[model samples]
Structure formats: C-alpha cells, structure tokens
Target chain A: MTVTLAIDCMGGDHGPSVTIPAALHFLRADRKARIILVGRTEAIEPHLGTALAEFGERLRVHRASEVVGMDEPPAQAMRSKKDSSMRVAVDLVKSGDAQAAVSAGNTGALMAISRFVLKTLPGIDRPAICSTLPTLRGQTHVLDLGANVDCSPEHLLQFAIMGAMLVAAVEHNERPSVGLLNIGEEEIKGNETVKQAGELLRKSGLNFYGNVEGNDIYKGTVDVVVCDGFVGNVALKTSEGLAQMLATFLREQFSRNWMTKLAAIFAMSALKGFKHKVDSRRYNGASLLGLRGVVVKSHGSADAFAFEQAIWRAAEAARNRLIERITERMERERSAA
Target chain B: MTVTLAIDCMGGDHGPSVTIPAALHFLRADRKARIILVGRTEAIEPHLGTALAEFGERLRVHRASEVVGMDEPPAQAMRSKKDSSMRVAVDLVKSGDAQAAVSAGNTGALMAISRFVLKTLPGIDRPAICSTLPTLRGQTHVLDLGANVDCSPEHLLQFAIMGAMLVAAVEHNERPSVGLLNIGEEEIKGNETVKQAGELLRKSGLNFYGNVEGNDIYKGTVDVVVCDGFVGNVALKTSEGLAQMLATFLREQFSRNWMTKLAAIFAMSALKGFKHKVDSRRYNGASLLGLRGVVVKSHGSADAFAFEQAIWRAAEAARNRLIERITERMERERSAA
Candidate 1:
C-alpha cells in the first residue's frame, strides 16, 4: 500500500525554495510513497523535474491557482482563497486521495481550512494541534499548541482526550499519562477554566496525571500535556525563544576570546548535537487531531530537513490509524457512559 | 545614608540555611548596609554566629513568633499568622526599619501580607511581581509573573505602568517601552481582556509598544512585558524549564564520550558563563511593585548565591525608590487625565 501525502507547496517562509526540494526529497527517499504537489504550476514544475527522474510515475502535481497570504486572517483567507494550495491540500485528504495532508502556511488558516474541508471527528468539540517536543527524558506531546485560544472547560477536556489518544497512537503506549498545564502542581492552582478542566479530567477516568507545572513539561513527567490554546501557544513559543536565545548566547560567549574560540572548535560536535536536540525542525509538524482526516502543519520556517520530518510524521500518523483510533476510543467511552 | 534590608529568615525552601548566610555575605560586601533578620529567635540565632560577629552592629534579629506554611492559602495564612516572619518582614519595610524587604516564602502569602501590611501605592489597583530574565538581546522584565492571574483591564493597565516604572527604575532607561503580551501582534488578535487592555494602554500612552507575541519576549524587543499572573507565570516557568532542559541536554551530550568529555573540559568556561547568564538564581528575586513598600521574593530553592542576589535586587529597588517613582508617575497621569 503506497502512502500518499498532499503538500501545500506555496506555504512556509521560504516557500518553494524549501518546500519544493523537500517534497522531492521525500518522494526520492520512499519508493512506496507518492506526493501530490499543490501549488502554482510555474513555480513548482521547475524544482520537481531534476528530483522527479528517480520517482517518475510516483510524483504528481495538482495546480492550486490561488495562494493564501501569511498575513491574512484565517477565516478571511479561507473564504477568499477557496482554491488555495493549503485548502486544496486539505481537500485531497478529505476526498481520500491522500492519506494525510501537510502544510506550512499560516497556522490559523491551515486549522480553519482543515476543519472546514476535513470536518471534525464525532464526539470532538474542537480540533487541536498536537506537537511533539524533545525533552530531557525523551519527547513529550503538548496539545492545542494553537488551535482554539479561548477554550472552555469542555473544550479543554475534549482536547485532553484527543491529545492522549494521539500520543498513544504515535508513541504506541497502552495508556499515556495526561497532565493539565497549570501554574502549580496543586489541584486548585489554575484559573477557572483550568480548575473546571481538572475536575472534568479527574472524572473522565483517563490516565490523568493531575496538574503539571510549566517547568514539568520538559522534565518528561507526563506523556501528554493539555491546555487551552492561549497558554499552550505561549509556552511553546517561549520554549522555542529561550532555546534559540541560549544557543545564540552560548555562541557569543565562546566567540568572546581566543581561549573560548579554541574551546568552540573542540566543542563544535557537542554544540551541533545539542542544537539538533532542541531544534524546532526536528519536531516541525503538528497534527490537527480530532478531525476526521489527517492534517499536519509544518513549521512556517521549515527547510528541507524539517519538511522531510513532516512527511515522516504524516506517514507515521497515517500508518498508526490515528483518526480511527481516536474515533474508536470516543465511541467506547460514549457507550460505557 | 546606609541601606537596610529586612531578611525573612523563615522564607524559602531551606529558609535560614540560605538566607542567613546570604545576608551576612551582603553585609560583608556593603559595610554601609544594615540587615534585620526577621524570624523566631531560636530559628535564626543558630544560623548567625561568626557572620553576625563580623557584621557587629550592622546585623539585628527581629523576633517574629509565627511562620506561614508552604501549603497554606495566602488570605488564610495572612489572617492567621499575624506575627509570621513574612508579616514581620513587611512590617520592617512599613515602619521604615528597613529600606526593603526580601522573602522567599509562600508567594501568595508574601503578596497578600505585603499588600495588607505595606498597602498599595496611590492610584494602584493591585501589586505586581516583576522579575528580569536573560533574553537573546539582553534582559527584559516580565511583570505580574504570578500575582494577579485573572486581572481586569484596569488592573492590567496598572501592571503595565508599574512594570515600566520598575524597569525604568532599575534599568535606568529614560522611557521604557511596555508590551502587552497577547496571542498575536495584531491589535485585535487576543481575547476580550487583551483587547480592552490594548485600548487602555494606547490611551494611557507612556511609551506603549503594541501587542507582543511569546517569541518576542526573549528577543528583548520591549523593556517590559505585561500580562496577567496566569499567562506571565506560564511564560516565565516555561522559559526557565526550557533553559534548564537545554543546559542539561548539552551537559549530557558533552559527557557522552571521551572526545566530547575533552571538548567539555575546553568549553567549561564558556558554558559556565552561559549558565550564569541564564541562571534563575542570578535574577531570582521579583519586586512586588505597586505596594507602598519595596518587597522582593527570592526563589523557593534559592541558595546563598541566589539569596545574595535577592539582597542586591532589594537594595537596587530601594535605592531607585521604585514605590515613590510609581506613585509620582500615577499622580502625573491622573493629573493629566
């Protein structure tokens, strides 16, 4: 069975410069994998040729006439650019032409288009963007990285269920421990939404790990960390920013004097490996879980390496039957209730 | 004139084990600075022997019979533990026995006790905790870190004003720019609280830089980042955890093999300096601004080094007359309005 991935070729900061080569690389690496390049013909055709010779029949292109601007509002952009590469990519998944859809466009736009085109899974109130972040112990999954900002307790509870399901699907865990992101570890520490969410989660009988603090996220204390989009987004971005800052600061420190500069030479390998561990590219794609169809959003600044990772992530999600597993779990819970 | 800092001997994770020695160190460093240790006589006397002898007349212990527990609620703790060390510390600041008060006790207890004992500055709705963190560019102040979680628009505006004032006071910037933290940079991107706060911030002027994203916090794009306690605490702890995780990962990578171990030895200085730059202990103390008196909270896990830094921070806040400056600024804004 060949895995098909629909790529929104006109997305991301570098656009075709990165995405085009990335798609070609993915097709070249996996002989059983096929890609439908969704973008303007003129831009993607040239880049696809040299790389497509090896996988001649496997690679195909579906020209998307309109491109969504990164600056446009997700709702407005979805309405205006109905035939955008992102929308078309999602549509392919909706139509069952592709196993999964991948886009590196405006996050809001991708979420909006994915939800509109693919629709939500039954028993799912809101779709959440779940991303895996590298942690000290290994990797931890954080949900609602930025799907719904002002989420209610019910929405958060739903996100928790979907997040746990997604993590279990990908990590192959029997039952992943879920944690609610809060200011403190105490049961009564967060805001009203979080407090209510905690109550619902406790009652939900999921493998809930009670409340976990922001510091606990990277400590690998829980398999799944759940929160409303606003706090989760802030935490994700803050982590990214801090990692970048630390890397930059280390470089500047090493470059200060000749002694430190020499140290930098010897430490280059370790530094590079450290960079790889924290690099956003290593975990670039976020799955929009709780949707009927699989839709992954690659980081906006994704390069070839990141895009390839996105393809691998998409393939993994599809192979794991993530949507089906979530549906089944929800159905079992509903029936039991 | 000599600076006097009231040390809460009963505060923090280890209490006097860290605080007493730290105060002695500060007293030794600054001969003109006086220290008043506030706690039970037996609790503090054991920690201060040779150190107090060296300081001679510079150090004095103010006996406070009661102590607030770590798990106690702030309001209940404040109401019950009237003679608590935290309360005594605030009393020192209120009665002008100490120029500033430093504590690492229960944060809520500290805030509540400070507000009750020292009172709020004129025209201030609530007190805010402002702490500095090392950023990519330099360092920036994040205010209301864990003080006012569910803040009103007016409270947020006050936090912004107080944050800017605190930054300007300590950083010595002529006019510090304040950024209202939101989900997006656009004026209309955040929830209702942010929208209303943005309008109030713009109208109030005072060098308001529009809404800033989480990524921008570490970029040091603005002097002061203002948000409600919940969001600010999340961002703060997330950044701290990320830095710690990265540092740990780098250490683990360096210790992986003989070659990496040699590189680690060579890179020790640069790595140490980088760690120092991002160390929470170096900037652990957060000034409780908007209160009539100056109060700083050291980290619960603060060591002697962290406690000393807290003392320094308190001294700086006192020297800058932060409360006076904030009051004057608020008065000026009110008069203009």
Candidate 2:
C-alpha cells in the first residue's frame, strides 16, 4: 500500500528551508510514498526548485494562507487559524488527500488542531503523544508526553492500549509488553490515580509488566511505558536536561586545552560513534496516537535530516495502518468488557 | 553551637564499612561537630578502631541491637524494629540528645520512623524530602523527592515555606526564589493541583518565580523547585537513568579497540574533571524538611566519600539550627494567616 504524508511546510523554526528538503529526501528514498506540501505557495515554491517537475503529482503543493506562530496559544490557534499550514496538513489527512500528517509546529497547537480536525478513534477517550526514547535494548515507547495533564485511570489504560498498539504496528511486535510508569516497582507505590491505573492495567490483557520506575524507560524493561501527561512530560524534559548537561560537560572537557584538543582528535571517531548512538535526531518524531488519522509531531527546531526522519516515521505508521490497529484493539477491549 | 548528629550506622548497603569511615572523615573535618554512632556494638567496633580514642568523648557509640534491612517494609520496620539503628538514631534527635539524625537506610522506613519520633512542626501538614541537584549555576533544591505523593495546595505552600527555611538555614540564602514544577511555565499549565499550588505560591509572599518546567531545575532558573513527591521522584530517577546511559556509552566508545583505548588514556584527565563536576556523590544528602528535628537521608548505596558528604550536610543543617528556622517560619506564617 502506498503511504502519503501531508507536510506542514510553513511550520517550525526553519519552516520551508528544512521541511522542503526533508520531504524531497523522503520522496527520493521511498518510491511508493507521496507528500502534499501544505503552506503558502511563494514560500514553498522557492525551495521546491526542480522537485515539482521531478516527482510530478507525487510531490504536490497545497496552498495554506496562515502560519501558526511557535508560541501561539492552543485555543487561539484553533479558533483563529483555520487555514494554517498545520491545520491544512491535518485537513489533508482528514479529507483522505493524505494518509498521515507530519508537522514540526507548536506541539500544543498541533495537538489541539489534530484533535479538533480528526477527532479520536471509537472507545478512545483521549489522544496521547507517544514517542520512542533510546534505551539499552534499543528503544521503548512512552505515551501522554504532554497532551493530558490530568489523566483518569481509564485514560491511563487507554494510553497503554494505544502505546502497545503503536509499538506493534510500527515495530511489528505481536505482543508488546506494557509497563505503567510509577515511582516504585511495587504495586502500592505512587498516588491514588496511578495505583488505580495499575490495577486496571493488571486485568487489561495487554501483556502488562506490572509497575516500572522512570529508569526502566531507559533500561528498556518494557516496550511501552504509560503515565499521565504531567509525569510523562516531566520525565521526558528531565531526560532532555540531563542529556544537555552531559553533552555540554563533555564538549567543555574535550576543548579545554591544547592537550585535550589533541586527545579529542584521537578520540574523535569513538566520540562520534557514541554521539550517533544517542542522537535525539534519530528519534525525532512523536506519534499523536488515538486520533482517527495518523499525525506525527516533529521537534520544532529539527534540522532537515531530523525532519526527514519524522516524515519517514509518519510514512511507516501510515503504511502499517496504526490507526486501524488502535481502533481494532480498543474495540476488542470494549467487547471483552 | 556544637552540632551533634545521631548516625544510623547499621543501615545502607555497606553498613558500618561505609558509615563508620565516613563518620570518622566527617569528624576530622569539623572540629565543632560530634557524631553519636547508633548501631550493633560488634559491627560498629570493628570499624571504629582508634577513632574512639582519637576523637575522645566527642565521638560516642550508642549501641542498638537490631538493624533495619534495606528492603524492609516501612510499617513492618516501624512496628517490630523499635531497637533498630534507624529508630535509635531518630530517637536521639527526638530526645534532644542530638540536634539531627543521618540515615542511609530504607527511605520509606526512615521517613516513617523520623515522622513518628520527631513529628511534623506546628503549621506544617507533612514533612518533605528536599535535596540539591547539580545545575548550570551550582545547584537548586527540589522537594518533596518521595515523601508526600498527593499534596494539596496548602501542603505545597507548607513545603515551599519549609524548603525555603532549609535553604536559608543551610545555604544561607534568605528569601530564596521558589518555582512550582509544572509542564509549562505558563499560568494555564499543569493539573488543578499544580495550578492551585501555583496560585498559593504566588500570593504566599515567598520569593515566587511563578511556574518552572523540568529543564528549569537544571538551568538553575530558580533557587528552589517545588513539586509533589511522585513527580519529583520520577524526574530524579529519570535523570539517573539518562546519566547512566551516557556514562556507559562513553565507556563503551572509549574501550572499543586498542586505538580508542590509547585515546582514552590521553583523555583520562579531561574525562575525570567532567565526571567530578557532575558526581552524584557531591549532592548526596536529601534533607527531610518540616520535621521537628532535622533528618538527612543518604543514598542507600553511597560510598564512603558520598556518605561523608551526607554527614557534612547534616552537620551544616544542625549547626545552622535548621529545625528552629523551620519552626519559627511556620509559626510566623500561622500568626499572619
């Protein structure tokens, strides 16, 4: 099946400069994939160059008059910017012009717009932001990064189902293990909501791995880690902070003096290898799971290479029919109940 | 004033092997500080050696027959282990025989024992675990690390007051700026609890910095970051996981081959410097705030150097009369309300 992704060309910090190149690269690699570049004609055309003639109808451009500001409030963006690049990208997905939407726009606005446009799948109470993080055993998926601050026990259970289905679809795992994110591995650990979520997950028939702590996410103890958006967001940002600090500290150490600089040259390949192993760009895309259509949000400041990765991720999700899988699983769960 | 700290020597992973040596090192550094070693006499005597004679009566060993296991349940330890070293240590602080207590035992049990023996100060609803984390501009204190999972707006306010007083007493930062830990710095971010806590913080007359996100904790955006224990614990553990991943990756990179191993030797000093700067041992002690008597908990697996740092932190808090500061501040706030 051919996977088509609608790209928000006028979004993110770099806008068309990054998005256009990324989309072109993605198209060059995947012969069966198609892209609809949604943005202002003038802005996108300047970067398209010969790509329009090269790919013909496979690389099409759709005009979007408005652009959502990076810092625009979600409510304001949803209410005012009906024709925004982000909104149009989701619209393409909703209208069946594209199978999936990919945007590096304001996360809150993207989530709001996607939820407003596509709505959620049947039996799914809310859509969750699911993303993969580098771990010892490759990668693990975590959900509800910042979409819902106050999640009910049912919401957490829904996240688990969505996250597990996401891993199964994209990673092609039949029965992915899911772990509820908690302060402790003990069942008695965490607040009332988390405890109740743990109980719900235990009987949810989703290959539950009981409770896993924050460290378990990186340890790759389970395929899916589910938590409320508040805790998940804090955990994600905290990991980012530590990674930044380590990177800064390492850079400072390797560039401190002439001797260290010389050592850095000798150790350059090893350092590069280590850097490649933990590159954030490698895991650039986050899936907005439970939506009726697939929507992947890229980091706003992602470069062309990173944005391309997000496009590929969206293509993979689209080709694998992630939305249908989630819908089916939720329906199965509902029928079982 | 001479500060006396009751040490739970028969606790933690290494027990007296780590605790006794750490106490001796601490005593050597601080002439005005005294330590009362509370543990099994036989286990304590083997490590004390000449320290008993060298420090004279300033270093006394108060024997406790039982030891609290690292994995012991909090309620079980509190009920049946009355003579446990952890209990004895807190008992000393409660009786005013020691100004503060230092333990490297089970966190849940330590908190339970301390709360039972020392009790919460007037106007303070519950005790909080406050610890300093390494940041860009030195460090920032965060609470509660794992004490109170479900905190009300009023409880968060009490935590802010107690955390501020602890900083004032130990770090000597009067009117320290406190930031509520939320998903976003915006007023509309986070759950109802955090939103209400933010409101309470803003009007409570403390040096409030509004809301700060997870990365702000490392950016040193504020002097203190306040959050419920559940969120704080997850953030802390998540950081530990990331740090470990980076360290392991770096090691694997440097030891890949003979050529890289040679590079490792050349980069050893620079790497060592970087490691020292972010050493978890330097930020060892977590102060249990809002208790009537100051109680500091060290990491259960802390090395001698790390345990010594915890001792020094306990001494510093005791010397500054942390309990008195918290009591007075709570009393003042109560009268004002």
**Clash count for each candidate, listed in order shown:** 1, 0
Candidate whose TM-score is highest: 2
CA lDDT of B233 in candidate 1? 91
Q: Could you give the TM-score of chain B for each candidate, in order?
A: 0.95, 0.98
lDDT of candidate 2 over B287-331, digit per residue (tens): 998888888999999999999999988888988878888888778
Clashing pairs in 1: B12-B104
State the weakest 10-residue window (summed lDDT) of model 1 chain A.
A48-57
lDDT of 2 at A53: 93
User: Which 10-residue window of candidate 1 chain B scores lowest in summed lDDT?
Assistant: B48-57
lDDT of 1 by residue, B1-337 (tens): 4889999999888988899999988888887899999999998888887866787779899999998888789999888888999998899899999989999899999999999998898889889889998777788998889877688998998998898888777889869999988888889777888899999889895899999889889998898998889989988887777777877888888998999999999999998898777777777798899998889999888999998998998998788878888988898878866
By DockQ thresholds, what CAPRI class is model 1?
Answer: medium
lDDT of 2 by residue, A22-64 (tens): 9999999999989999999999999988998999889999999
Candidate 2 CAPRI level: high
B106 Cα displacement, candidate 2 (Å) = 0.8
